[model samples]
Target: MKQKIVIKVNIHCQKCRSKAMEIAAVADGVISVAIEGKEQDQVVVIGDGVDSACLVKRLRKKVGYAYLVTVEEVKPKEEKKEEKKEEKKGEKPTCQPQCHGYPYFVHYETVDEPNPSICSIM
Candidate 1:
C-alpha cells in the first residue's frame, strides 16, 4: 500500500469534474477523488502507489488546463488557476507548426512554402 497524496488540479464544471474522476479512477491504484472549491477544479485523490507526475499530466491534458500542481505546494486552487490564466493572456503559442498538420516537415519553412525551382520538376 502507498500513501495517499493530495493533488490540486484545475477542472471546469460538474461534467469536467466527473470526467476527471473517471479518468483518475482508471489509473493503476487510485482509491477515490474529492474535489474542493467552487470552480470544480480543486481535487484530492486518495490512492496507493500512484504516480503524482503522471496523474497531474493526464488531468491537465484531459481537463484542458495549463497548470497542475500539488495541493500542498500551492494552497487555494482559485489563486493558482487565476495566476495561470493571467499568465496565459500574454504568452501566445510559438510560430512553429505541429506534426499533426503536416507529416512531411516539422516546421513551416519546409512545409508551408513550395520551392520555386522544384515547381518546374513537378
Candidate 2:
C-alpha cells in the first residue's frame, strides 16, 4: 500500500531541515521525501509500508521535536501517453533520449590488444 506521511518537525535552519529529510529518506520503503509546510518545517514522506512512528522518533532524536501531521493512503496517478505513428524504415524516430543527472563518465577508451595468449592458470 502506498502511504503519504507528513511530519511536523522543528527545523530551525537549512541544516536541520536537510537532516530531517535525510533521516526520513533512509527509512525502509521510502519512495520520496520533501520538506514542506509554510515554515518549511514539515517533512513529507511517501512510501510503501513506512513506519510513521519510528520515523518521527528518529527525527526527534536527530533533528528536533517532531510529530505526525497526517498519515493517509495515496493513490498513484496514471498518465496518458500519446500513440506514435508508424515510421518509414529510413526515417529516424521522433523521440530523443534524455539524460536526467550528471553523467558519471563521458566515454570509455577501448584498448586494442596487440597479441592474444592462452591462459596458463588452468
Per-residue lDDT tens digits of candidate 1, residues 1-122?
Answer: 53455556655567887887786676665657777656656667776666666777777778766344443322333455545423456754543312224356455454565554565655
Give the count of colliding residue pairs in each prediction.
1, 0
lDDT by candidate, in order shown: 0.61, 0.83
1-122: candidate 2 lDDT, tens digit per residue:
89999999998998898888888887877889998789998899999988888888888889889999999999867734654334568854433222234568778799978896778996
lDDT, residue 37, candidate 1: 56
lDDT of 2 at 91: 53
The model with the greatest TM-score is 2
Q: Which residue pairs of candidate 1 clash? A: 11-41
* TM-scores vs. true structure, each candidate: 0.49, 0.63
Report the error of model 2 at residue 38, Å. Answer: 0.6
lDDT for 122 in candidate 1 is 58
TM-score computed on alpha carbons, candidate 1: 0.49
